[model samples]
Target: MAELSAPTGREPGLRAVPRPDGTMPRALVIGATGYLGGRLVPRLLAAGYAVRVLARAPERVRAFQWGDDVEVVEGAAAEAAAVRRAVADVDVVYYLVHSMAAGTGFEEADRRAAQTVADAAAAAGVGRIVYLGGLHPDDVPLSPHLRSRVEVGQILLDSGVPTLVLQAGVVIGSGSASFEMVRHLTDVLPYMPAPRWVRNRIQPIAVRDVLHYLLGAARVDPAVNRAVDIGGPDVLRYGQMMNGYAVVAGLRQRAIAALPVLTPRLASHWVNLVTPIPRSIARPLVESLQNDCVVKDDDVDALIPPPAAGLTPYRRAVALALGRVEADDVETSWRDAELSGVPSDPLPSDPDWAGRAVFTDARSARTPAPPDRLWAVVEGIGGENGWYSSPVLWALRGWMDRIVGGVGLARGRRSRRRLAVGDALDFWRVEAVEPGRLLRLRAEMKVPGLAWLELRVAPEGTGARYDQRAVFFPQGLAGRLYWLAVLPFHGFIFRGMANRITAAAARAS
Candidate 1:
C-alpha cells in the first residue's frame, strides 16, 4: 500500500454535520475487536448512544455480550470502502483501530489506516473524530508504538475533520493487555528482575476512566481538534504497579529489581508466554511503557469532565480488576451471576518471533514403544507426571524459578492426561499440542531469555523416536551467559529426559 499523503498544514474546510441537542448521537467505533473497543461498545450502548462497529471480522464483534445491539460494518480500517461505510451518517467516528499488532511495517499500516479513516470521516461529515493514542513526552525519542500513535493523531487532526485525540498512559483494567502483562507476571513471579525502564514513571488510567473520557469525547466541542493527555490520579513507577497489584491480590510483597541485562523487547516476549494476549500486541505494549508514560498536561480536563467519582487510583483499579479474575470465587463482578466477559480477551493472532539470538539443544532417543504410546507419556509430563529425566534437577530448577518469582511447578496441568494449547502446565505454557505426536511448551519460568521445550514422537523402525529440543532466545549478554552456565546440565537433564520419557512410554504399553 502507498504511504499516506503529506498532511496539508492548512486545515481543510470539510467538517462533520452538526447534530440536534436532543437527538441520539450516532457513534461509529473502528477496531471493535480490541479490548478497549469491546469494553467501550457496551458502555457506549449503556450511555444511550446509537452505536455502530466496524470490524475486520464481524463475527468477533458479535461474540461480545452487547454485540447484537450495534450496527456492524464488515471490513478493516485499512479498507477505504469499509471506512467510508463505517463513517457514513455517524456523529462521532472513533479511531480506536491501530496496526501495531499487525507485525512488520506496523507504522506504515497505522498511517495508511488512520489516513483512510481520517479521509472517510472528513468526507462523511462526522461530528467529531476521537482517537485513543499513546502518552509520551514530546522531548524524547519515542518507541515505534508511541511514534505511530502520535503520527496517526496528526494524520487525523490534519484531515480537517474536528478530531479529539486522547493520549492515554498505561491503561489498568481487566482485559487490558498491559494490565494483563503486569497481572500474570506479578501473579506468577514473586521476585521480578525487570528492565531498568521498570523504574520509569507511568500514570496508568483505569479502563472505567478511559471509557468515561471516551463517552465524554463523543459530545466534545467541535472547536477541539488537538491531542489531549489523559491519565489516572497516581503516578507510580512500572515496578510499583506490579506490587500494587500484589497488594490488591493479597499476595506477599513483590521484590522488583531493575536489571540492566534484561531488555524490554525480549522482556515483552517473555511476558507474552504467560499472558493470554496476542503475540503481536505485547511487544508494542511493553516497549511503549519502557519510557515514562504519564500525562504531561490536564488538557483532557478542559475537554471532558472527570468521572463523577473522580478518576480511579492505580491500586484501586488493580483491586477492582483483580476482583474480576480470582479463581472463580465471587469477588469482583462487572455484571450479574455469570461473568459475561473474560479479562483474558485476546486480540488477533500474529507470530511473535522474528530476528533474535537463538540457542538450541536437540536430543532424541529411540523407544520400542509406538508414537501414540510415547505421546501419552509426553503429554502427561508436567504437573503430577513430573519431568521424566530428573526429579532433583527439575525440582531445583523449579525452586530457582520460584525464588526469582517465576510460576515454578506448583501450577500443574489442568488435566492429568490431556494437553491443549494455551494450558498452563507447571512453569511451562502449552504453546502447541498435536495429540499423539507433539507438544511444545513455552517456558513461563523466570529466565534471562525466552525459552521453549519441544517434545515430539516420530515413527522410526519398529519403535518410535522421541525427539526433544530446547530453544532459548537470549535477550543480551546475560542471556548468553545464562545458557553457558547451564550448558553442562543439558546433557544430564535433557538427554535423560528423552531417554526416561521413552522408557516410561514403553513401560506404559
Candidate 2:
C-alpha cells in the first residue's frame, strides 16, 4: 500500500467510485476516541472488520488499545488532506466528528468538517458512510445544536455515498452530555427549578446499543443506506430521565418545579454555574433541550433485525451508568472535547474581584512509595494524562489561569522526583507539610476568594484513599459570582484530579 497523501486544507471535489476493498471491509472511525467512537471501534474489530481511527491528537484517545490492535492516524478530520489519507484504504467511513463546543461557529465548522469527510471518502472510493446524529423533529424549531446535527447528516447524504445515518436522542451513557446534565441536576440539586424542556419526552439509548447499531451497520452489506431511528425500549420525559438518574445514582428523587422564567440563556448560566460545562458549550446544549427528541419512526428496525443486536433497557442502562460513575471508568463522551487539547482563552475577569482572599483544600492519601511517585501523577494531572480522563484540558485551563496573574502550573512543586514544604509548586505555594503524611499549598492566584490545595494520606483497605479538593470562599458578589461561573468546570477538573491521583497512587503502590 502506497503512503496516502495527508490532507492539507480543503478537500478536492471527487466522485463516488467503488472501493477496491469492498470485498473485505475496513472501517475508519473519525473521532474514534469519542464516547460513541470509542465503543464502536472495539465492536467493529470484534465483528471482524479492520478498524482505524483519525484523531486530532491521538494521545487524547487513550482508551483505544494500540499496538497492532488498532491503527491510529494523527490529524484533524476537518482537514481535507487528513480525511483523504484516513479514508483512502477503508471501505466504511464513520463520520463521528462534531464541534459541539465550538460555540457560534459550531454549525459552520460542523458543515465543513462533514463535507471534508464526505469528499475524502468519496475520493477514496469508500464503500459506505455511517453518521450518528441527534434526533429532532423537522417541524419543531430545532435548536442550533440539534439543527447542525441534522444538517451535517444531510451533508453526508449529499455525498452520494451509501450512508447509514442513525438519528438518536439522549444516549444513556455515563459520559453523555444529556446524561451528565441529568446526573448533575439530580445529584446536586435536591430541589430543582428547570425549564419547560424537562417535561418534553425523549427516547434514550444505551451507549452499548449505539455501538451495536454502528457495528451492525459496518457488517451488513452496503445496501442498507437509509436513515434509521434507533432508540431504547422506553420513552421518558427529561424530568423522568432525571428521576431515573437520581434513583440509579443513589440520590433521592428530586422534585423539579418547571419555571417559565428560566430561559435557555439563564438556564445555561445556571448550568454553567453547577456543571463542568462552560457557558459557551452549555448554552447551545441547554437550548437544544427545548426540542422533544423522541424517536418518531421505527421503520429502519425492520431492515436491521433487532435480534442481531440485543438492546439494554433504560433501567439497565441507567444501572450501567451508575456503575461506571462509581467506578469512574467513563471514557469518550461529548465532554471529552473540553478534555481534548483545545486551547481555550481565559474567561474575562473583574477589577473589583481583586484583593479577595482565596484558599484551596486538596487531600491525597499516599502509598508506601515516596511523594515523588504521587508527584509524578500530580505533575501529569491535567493534559495527556487526562488529569487520567483528559489531562490536556486541565493543563490548558491551569495554564490560562496562571497567565491571567493567577498561579499558572509554573508553581506546581519542587522537583518531579522530590517533595518538601515551602516549595513553590507551579502556581501553588506550599504552606504546610509533614513528611509523607500531608502537603498543603496556599493559592497565590488572582481571584475574589480564598483557595488552597492540600494532600493528606490515610489507609484504606490495603491501599490509601486519595481525596483531592479545591475549596473557594467568596469575598462578596464577585467571589460568589466566580464560584458559580466555574462550578461545572470543577466537576470535571476535580473528578479528573482525584482519578489521576488515585491511579498514580495505585501504580506507585
* Per-candidate alpha-carbon RMSD to the true structure: 12.3, 12.1
Estimated TM-score per prediction? 0.63, 0.67
Best by lDDT: 1
lDDT of 2 by residue, 388-494 (tens): 53456656766566344333443232233333333344545445555455655555456676666656655555555665666665678898888787776665666
Query: What is the Cα-based TM-score of model 1?
Result: 0.63
Predicted candidate 1 versus true structure: per-residue lDDT over 1-509, tens digit per residue: 11111111111211122356666778899866565675667666655678899876554455455678999989878899988888888988888877555556878988999988888888888878999988898788888878888999999999999999898888877546677778778888878878888889999988778877777787777888898899999999988888888888889988988888877667765665554433355667777877777788787777777765688898888877666554322111111111111112222122444555688899988989888898888888877678987789998987676554445675555455666554567777666667778787777666777788888889999889988889887878999999999999999899889889989989988
Q: Candidate 1: give the clashing pairs.
A: 16-125, 189-405, 190-405, 191-405
Query: What is the C-alpha local distance difference test score of candidate 2?
Result: 0.65
Off by over 4 Å in 1: 1-18, 273-279, 327-509
Q: lDDT of each prediction vs. the true structure?
A: 0.73, 0.65
Q: Highest TM-score, which number?
A: 2
